[model samples]
Target: MKPKIELLAPGGDVQAIKAAIIAGADAVYCGLDTFNARNRAANISFDQLVGIIRLAHQYDCQIFLTLNIVILEQEFKTLFNLLNKLVNTTLDGVIVQDMGLLYVLHHYFPTLDIHASTQLTTHNAGQIPFLKKLGVSRVNLSRELNLREITALAKVGQEHDTLLEVFVHGSLCVAFSGLCYSTSASAGNSGNRGRCSQACREEYETTESGHNFPLNIKDNSAFFDLPALIEAGVYSFKVEGRIKGASYVHTVIDSFRKQIDGYVATGELTQDGERLYKVFNRDFTNAFLRGDLNQSMFIDNPRDNSNNHLVDKLKAEKGESISVVQIHSAQQQLQVDKQQITSSVDEKIAHLSIEKIKLSLSFASELDGPLRLTVVTEQSDSLLPGQAVKTDSQVFTSSSVMIPSEELSVDRQAIEKRFKSINNANYELVELDTQQLTDGLSIPFREITTLKNELLSYLNAGVAMIAHVQPPKLEHHPKADGPLGLSMLICDEADVALADMTDGDIYFKLPDAYKRGCTKYVDFLLQNPRLIPWFPPVLIGKDFEVALNILQQVKPKLIVTNNTGIAYHAEQLGIQWIAGPFLNTTNSYALLALKQGAACSGAFISNEINRQQIKQIARPKDFKLLYSIYHPILLMASRQCFFQQSVGCEKPRIDNGCMLSCDKSTSIKNLKGDSFAIDKQKAGYPSIYNQDQFLNTDIINDLSDKFDGFMIDLTNIGAGDRVSPDKVELITQFQALLDGQSEASAKLSRLVPESTLLQYQNGL
Candidate 1:
C-alpha cells in the first residue's frame, strides 16, 4: 500500500488542539505565546503546551510546534530556554522559517526533526539541496507554485530523500510570504515577527476612480486537486488558520478528514465542497494550484460575512451542547458553563475527556519452565522526546505446573483467548507476541486471570515513574566578529547617475522592475564596474525563466535577490549574489548560512531589527554587511492592481500588457488617513510605500566603524511625504550625511518635513 498522506490541522489554542484531534486530524500544528506567526491568536502558554503535547500523543496524533517567526540576536536566549523546556515533552518536530534558528536547532538537538516553513519562499527545486544539507526533513513549498511546478519540486524532493508539504486550503497573500513588509512599514508590526496588522485587507482610492480593496486576494481552496497532489508525492496537506476558533477548526478538519479518507479508500472524494465554503472564506480560488492565473481570484463583494447560517447548520447537525472552555482566561474561566460567541462562528461547545495508554506485550510459556509474560510500557523523557521508551522490559514469571496430556491441555489457542479477555478502557494493546509449548502442559483458567491482573498493576506503576522525568539545562553561545561594508540601492536612472558621482567603492542597485527600455543605461553604468541587478521577490514560472535569461546575457558580476527561486537561478547561472533586506537577515548565523548556501557576497540587515540588536550581531571576517539610513520603506508589493480595480476592469491584471489607467504619480489614502505612494510600473503590480520617509542621520557616526557602509535608498522619493523633486539635490543632501557633514541633519529636516526613526531606536 502507498504511504498515507498526512492531514495537518491548525490549533490556535488548547481548545482548538483538542477539537482537531477529536475531529480526526492525523497531526496538528500549534504555537505557544511567543515565537510563532499568529501572535494575535490566543496561543497556549508554555505550561499549557506540555499538557497539550501529552494529550495529542495520547490520541495517537502528532504535534509539530510552530517556531516560524524570525529571531533577533537578543531573542535567542528566550528561544533556547523554550526549546530546553520542550526537551522533556513529546513534541514530534518543529516548523522553522529562519535559517539561523534551523541551524542552531539541528546542531543542538540532533534528534529532533526540522521542517522548512513556507516563509522561506521555497518555490523551486533548485533550493532543495541547500535546505536538505541544513537538516530539513521536509520543505513547505511556497503557495505561489502551480501544479506542474509543485510536481517538479516533489520529484526533486524524492530524489533527495526529503518530504514535501503544501498548503491545500488557506487565505492567500497578495505578496509572497516573507517578501511582504506592509504591516511593518505602515504599523510598526512586522509579519516576519508575528505581529502583522494585515495592511492588505484595507481600502484605498485610485487616481482615476473611487475607493476599493485592490490588495485583498481571495482565500485558496484545493479540495478538487487532492488526488493530483497525493499522486505527485506530497507527504502532507496543510490547512492554514491558527487564529481561527475551535468550531471552524473542527468543521474544516473533519470535512477534510472525510475527503482524504474517502480519496484513499475509493479514489473519490465523499465530502461536499460547499460545506468547506460555508465554514468560512473570503472567496475560493485554485488559480495558482491549477496553473491558471488568468481567472478572477478576487471577490466583488469582499466584506459581507455570509457564513453565519452555515455555522448554525453545522451546530444543529452535531446535536450536542458543546461549550468551548477558555481555560487560560480568568474571566472566561469563571463562565465555563456559559456559551461564548467567537468571531468565526456562534456555536455551543461541550467538553469530553478520554485517556488511553499504548503498550506492547510479549508472552513465553515453555514445557518444563515457568510462564513468563513481559509488558513494555512506553515513556516520553526529556532526553528521548517523541521517541518510544520501554520503561518495563523485564519479564514477570509465574509458578510452573506439569500434567497428563488428556487431563486439561492448555493449548496456544486457549492461552491467546485468555489474554484477549483482559480489557480496560485506558489501555491500548499496540502489539502482542506469543510463544506456545502445548505438549503435556495443563494449567487452570483461574491462574491465567490472576497473572493478567498482576501484570496490569505492574504496568500502571511503571507509567507513573516515567511521567515524572525532568528536562536538562542547556548551554549558551558566545558572540563573534565579522566584516562590514556599504552599498546604495537606487530606483531610477537619475539616482544611478547621482550614485556615479559619489566617492568610495559603492555598488548601484537596479530596481526589480527594470524594463527592456532601461538597458541603454546599463552599459553606461557598467563603466564603474559596480552595478547589481535586483530580482523581484515573487519570481516564478515564465517570469523567473525570463529573468534568468536576461541575467545570463548581462553577465553581471553580482546579483541581489530576496526570493529563494531567484537565489537558485543565480546559483545555477554561476553568478554571486547578495541577500536582500526582504530576506529578513536578523542574526549573524543567518548571514553565514546565506553566504555559504546561496553563495552570497554580502547581506543587508533587516529594517525591523533595533539598533541594540543590530549592534549585538556577531560579524564574520569574510561576510560584508550594509545598513540603510534613508529610504521610503516599502509597505507592500501586491499582485492586485489598485488602478485596474478602481477603473472597474473585470479581467485579472497580472501581466504588464494590461494598461495602468491611473495617473502614474498618484497616491492612495488609507482608512488611517495616511497617504501611500503607489508605483504600478513594476510588472503591473502596485508597490506601496509608507507616507513618512525613514531618516536615521543621528546614529550614522556611531555605526560607521562597525558597518562597512551606510545606504541611502532614493527609489521612490517623489512618492514620500516631503522631498524635493530635483534628483541632484536629493543625492547631494544624502551624500553630505554619508560624509558626516555637521549641517546635514538640519538640511535633511528642511528638505523633508516628517520622517520616522523606524526601529533604529526600538525593536519589534
Candidate 2:
C-alpha cells in the first residue's frame, strides 16, 4: 500500500519554516541557534523553537527539533536542562543525531518520542527492530538508500512494528552523516560535534596524480540527489534547504508537493525535477542512489556557460515523448495501444479522451513496447471518457537513446549481491537486564548461574551468542558456567576481549597500546595464544615514522587510522591496514573508495548502520564489525578525549567545553535515578564521557553477515553510563543470534527464561 506520504521540509529560520509550511509541507525540522548539529544555519532560539512548535501544531503540522549535533560533556547540563523545559511543550519529538543525547533523553524523558536523526546513518532493515527496542518510535532512514532498498526497509518496519521515515528531498552529502570529516580533518572543528566548516563545498585538484587519481586530487563540489528518492518510498519526504532562502523553500516545497501529490494519484514522478535544482544544485546526479558515482555528476562550475545548453539538451531528450500509458481506478481499467484504444465497458467511464484518459482514475497502456505505464486519477471525466490512444510519431522521433547493458549489469550485480546475502546465517540473543549499581556491587551468584543457564539454552536452541546485561564477572567467571566456556557471551568492547585475555574470566578488555610495543606482552600472547585486543588504539606519535618504528618492533596484526592520514603514512610504509571509526564510512562506495586508502586489512565504522548497510560498506572479506553497537555513536580521537586534558573539571558546573546545561533536567525523571552529568571538578577531568549510539544484538547479526568480528564498545559504560549487564546481554544475544542459523535468523526477544545451569566445555 502507498504510504500516507508527508512532505517534510527543513526550516532554519521563521521565514523558511513559514514558506515551507505554506507551500504545503507536512512537517519541518530545524534546530536551535546554539546546540543544533547544523550550527551554521540560521537556527531559531529556544524561545523561537517553542513558538514555532506551537504555530506548527496550530497548523496541524509537526515540528521536529534538531538536537542532531554530537554533544560534549560540558554541554550535557545545559542540554538536559533545556530538554527538561521543552518536554512540556507541544512540540513533537526532537530529531536527535547524537546517541549520548538519545540516552539522556531516554533516561530522563522516556515518554518523549525520538526520531533517529539521519545523522545516525541508519541504512539497514536489521537496524529497525533494534531501534524500536531502544525506544526509538520513528527512524529517518539514511539518505543512502535507493528506492528498492527503501521499499524492503518499509516492509521490515511493518514487520517489526516500527515507523520508518525517509528523506524525500534534501541536501545530499557526499559522505555519510557526521562521518564527513573534511572540515575537522582540514581545520580543528569536527562536524560530528557541530562545528563543521563545509570543507567539501570547496574545489581543488592536484595536478600531480599518483597511482590514485581522484582521491589524490581534491574535488569539492555540492551534489544533490533528492528528487528520485522522494519519488521512491521515503514516508516523510524531507527537503534539504534550512540554510536556503524562503524563495528556495517555497519553490522546492511547491515542486516536491506537486511530485508527492502526483505520486499519490499516479504512482510516478516526472523526470528532471529541476525546481529545487534550479534554485541551487551542484549539477545534480542521483548521488550514489543511481548505484554508481559517474564523473558527470560532479558539477565543477555552476556558472559554466555551456551548462545551460547541456542541461537544456538533457531535459529535451528526457521530455521528448510524453505518452498516456495507463490509468488505474477502483474496479475500472483501460488499455492504450499505438494502433488503437480499448476502454473498460463500465458505461459511466467509456466517454474519456486520451487526455482525459491520461488523467482518469484507472488506465493502462504500453509505451515503447516494454514500458507498461499505469496511472490513477481522483475523479472520472464524463465529457471525454478513458480510451486507448496513440501519440504522433514526431513526439519520440528525436529522443532515441541507447541503454548501456554494461552499466545495467554492474548495477544489477551490486544491488542483487548486496540483497542476496541478507538471508545468510543470523539470529539474536535476548537477555533480561537490571540497572548497574555504580558502586560496583556484584549480583548474587544464584542469579548469575540462572542467567548463564538461559544463555546456554539459547545456544543449544541454535543461538550463537548469549546477550545479557550481567557483569563480566558473572558472564565469564569459571564457576558461573561450571568452568566451561559455553557459547561466547556477547559483550561490548570493554569486556569482549578482556574476557578472552583473563582466561575467559574477565569481560572487559584493557587498552592494548601498553601491550603492543612491549616484548613481554608479545611473549605472553604467544604463550597464551587465546588473547584478543579490544578497543585497540593506534598510537600515532608526531606522524607515521614513529608508528612505523612501533609496528616494526611490535609487528601488531592491525594498524588503524583515518583514510587520508593512513593513506599518506601507509604509502610510505607498505602494509595492509584497518580503517578506524574516525573514517566514518557508511556506504559501499566509501568502503570501496578506501580499499587502498591505507591498504586496510579491515575498516572500522560507526554503529549507526544495520547489517545490510554494513555489507555495502565492507565486502565479506575486508570488514570487521568492531564494537557491534554502542548507544549514541561518538566521534572522538582518544588523543582528544576531554579526560586527557585536565583533572579538575569533573565537577558539574557551567564551564567551557560543556554543551549541556544540567540544571534544566531537575524535574525530568531518569530510569536510573537522576542521571547526572560527568563531574569535571573533583576528577580534574571532564566527567562527560563520549556517548555511543545504542545498538543491539539483532543489528549485530546483520553486522556478522558483512564483517569478520564485532567490537562491543562499553567505554562509556564504566566511565559514566558504565557497561551494564543489559548492554552485555545485548552483545551475548547478538552472538547467539548468529551461531547456528542457516538463514537470516533472529530470536524474538523472549524475556530470558528461567533455567538450570548446564556445563559444556570447549578447548581453545
Candidate 3:
C-alpha cells in the first residue's frame, strides 16, 4: 500500500512561514537564528518559532525545525540548552544531521521526534535500519536516487517503521549533499554547516565546450511524476529553498498543493505546472528522477529562468524572432505575475499571527487561607493596543497560608518576584493583581517556590518541568602504545612494493560505480593479499550488490569504506571495517555511535577540523583514531558528467559505459584566477578538486598523541595539470615525517610545492 503523501514546504522567514501555512502546505521545515544549517536565511527567533508553531497547528500543518549542521565539541552545551527549550514547546519534530544530537535526544528528550537530515546522504537500503536503530522516525532520502531505488528503500523503511522523504521540487545540488567541500576548502564556509557559497553556480572561464557555467544544472521538479512517487510508497515530498522569499515559497507551494490534490481526487494532474515558472527557477528537469542522465540537465544560466522562459513563450506565440521591445514586454509581464503572487499571499496570511501571548496573573489571599492564583492568557494583537481577548485560563491553588513571623509576608512584591520568569519566549506575565495578599499571610519559602513551579507547569499545558541535563562525564581512553602503523592509498596494483619498502599499510581505492557481475576486482584482491580493499563513497543498485559480492568472495580480514551501506553490511558479516574519512566524524559522541551502531574498530577523523577540535574528541575504548595528512582536496562529486559542458562529449547522455571508458581531466579557472581540477576516472564519478593538495604536517607535532595512525594519498586521480611526484618518494617522506625526522617535511614540501591547510586552520 502507498503511504500518505505530505506536501512539505520551506520557511526562511516569518512571512514565508505564514505563506506556507496559507498556501495549504501539509508540513513546513524552517530554521531558527542559531544552530540551524541555513545561516544565510532570515531565520526566525525562539519566540517567533513558538508563535509560529501555534499558528501552523491551527491549520492542521506540522512544523519541523532544522538542526541539520555537524556538531562540534565546544558547542554541545549550547545545543543541549536549545534542546531543553525545544522539548517544552509544541514543536512537531526536529530534522537533524549530527549523530551526537541523536544520542542525546534519544536519551534525554524522548518526546522530540527525530527526522534524519539529507546531510546523512541516505540512499541504499542498508542505511534505513542503520538510522532507525538510532531512533530516527523519518529520513530525507538523497536527492540522486531514482524511482526504482526509492521504491526499494521505501520498502525497507516500512519494515522498520521509518518514513522516507524525497526532494520533489527544488534546486538540485551538483554533488552529493554531505560530501561536497567546495567552499570549505577555499574559504572557512562549509556546506555541511549550511554556509555554501554556491560555487557550482559561479561563472567560469569558457571551456573547450564553450560554456561558462559547466557545473550548474537546472532545478529539479517532479510535478508529472507524482503518481510514480506515490506508487513508490514515499511518505513526504519536500521542496528545497529556505533562502527563497515568501512570494517564491507561496507560489511553489500553492501550485504543488493543487496538483497533488487534483491528482489524488480525480486521478489526473489538472495543473500543467506552468505557474511554477512564474517565480524563480532554472527551467526544470526530472532527469534524475527518471534515471536518465543527459546533457540537457546542464543549463548555461544559473540565475532565474522565468523571464527567459516568458520571452521564449512570447516568441513562439508570435512566430517571430525575439525583439528588444518584445523582451521588455516579457520582463514587465513577469513582474506583474510576481506582484500578483505576492499580493495574493499577503492577503491570505493577514489573519495569522505569531505575536507573543499575553498573560494576566491574579493573586488573592486571606487570613489563614490557601494561596489562590488565577492565570489568564490573552492573544496579543498589534491592532488592539490596550485591550486583548482572553484565550486560556487556569486556577492553581496551593497549601494553606500560615501566620507570618520569621519569613516575609506574601505581599504584591513577593508574589511578583516569585513568578516573573514566566515572562519569556512563550508569554508576557506583566498584569499581576495581588491586592488581597497584603493581609500579611505567608507560607514557607520552599513552599512558595514549589507553588510557583506548579503554576509554571500548568501554564505550559500540563508539561512537567524538565531539569537541565548536564554534560555527561566521559573517561578519556588513550590510544595504545606503538603507532597503529602508517598507511597510504593507491589505486594501482604496481604500488604494492612501496608498502614493503616504506613500512606502511597499503589500501586499494575502489571505484564509485561498477559493472554488474564484474569479478575483476574480486580476482585482483584475492591474488594480491597485501592490498586492503578501500570502498568508495557511492554504490547504488547493481553496483552495491557487486561490491557486496566482492566483500563476501574475498573475505578480507579488514577493509576501509566511506559508504555507511558498506559499513552496515560489514558489521553483520563480522568483517573488521574502519569508517573512512568521508563519514564526517566530528564529536566524541559520534565516535560512540559508530562503535555501538556498527562495532566499528577505527575511523579517520575528518580533515575539516583543526588541532584543537581533533584533541577534544574522546576516543571510544579499543577504537583507533586516524587522520589523513596528505591528499588531493576533493570539492565535489556528481552523478552528472561535467565533461558534457566542459570539454564536450559526443554522447547525448551518460550510461554505464561512460563510467568504464570515459577518463577526462580539465581545469576551470574562476574569475579570481583560482583554478580547480575536474577529473573523471574510469568507473568513477566526475569530481572537482583544489589545484593544491592538502598537506598538513603540523598535526604530527601538534597532537600526535591524539591519533593512532596517519595516511597519505598516492593516487593520481586528482592530480589534474600538475604531475605528481614518484609514489615511492611520497611514501618514504611521509613515513619519515611520522618518525619525527625534521627534514622530511621540507623535502616533501619541495616535491609538492602547492598545498593547503585551510580546513585544518578554520576548525569548523
In model 1, what lDDT does residue 63 have?
90
List, residue by residue over 1-764, the lDDT tens digit for candidate 1. Answer: 95678989999987787778777888999998889999998987765665566666666789999999898887777777677656544578899999888767766665568999988888765567768877899999988777888888899899989999999987788777776777676455888888877776776554354446756777888888899999888999999988877876877887888888888889888877755654557867898787655536755445533343344444576545533332124233323322232322232223323224556667766566666778776544322324434365657767655444666666666666876644333356776776545556666667776677677556444321122222223222232243233356665655556656666344454333434344443564555556667665665555555565666667777777766666766777788887777788898768767766567777778888777788777766566677777777677665455545444446554454442232244576766677777655534345677777787776677666557666766565336334444556666776777666779778887676667876676666
- Model 2, range 1-764, lDDT digits (tens) per residue? 65576778888877677666666778888888766777777887765665566446545678888887655434555765677656555567778765445555665576567887766656554446545544577888766555666776777777867667765454555445645443342233666656766533333332121111111111211123333444453566666767766656776777777766766578666434644434544444453444333333333343322234334545576574523331122112211220121111122223322121112111111222211112222222223325334321101111222223422322222323322322211111121111211122222234324433433333222233223221111111111112212122222333444353223212222231232233443454344334332222222222223333443444434445432333334434564555556444444333433443224455655443334433333242334334333332222211111221122124333222232122111011123232222222221222222222333444443434444444444344223433333544544554454454433223323322211111001000
Q: List the residue pairs that clash in candidate 3.
A: none
lDDT of 2: 0.43
Sorted by lDDT (best first), the order is: 3, 1, 2
Q: What shift in Å separates residue 239 of candidate 3 from its native position after superposition?
A: 0.6
Query: Please, what are the lDDT tens digits per residue for candidate 3 over residues 253-370?
Result: 9999999889888888889988999989999999999999999998999999998888788878887766889789779977987999889888777767787788988988776777
Candidate 2 to truth, TM: 0.43
User: How far in Å is the alpha carbon of 480 misplaced in model 1?
Assistant: 15
Q: Please, what is the TM-score per model?
A: 0.74, 0.43, 0.96
Model 3 gets an lDDT of: 0.87
Residue 757, model 2: lDDT of 10
Q: What value does the lDDT take at residue 353 in candidate 2? A: 20
Worst 10 residues of 1 by lDDT: 463-472
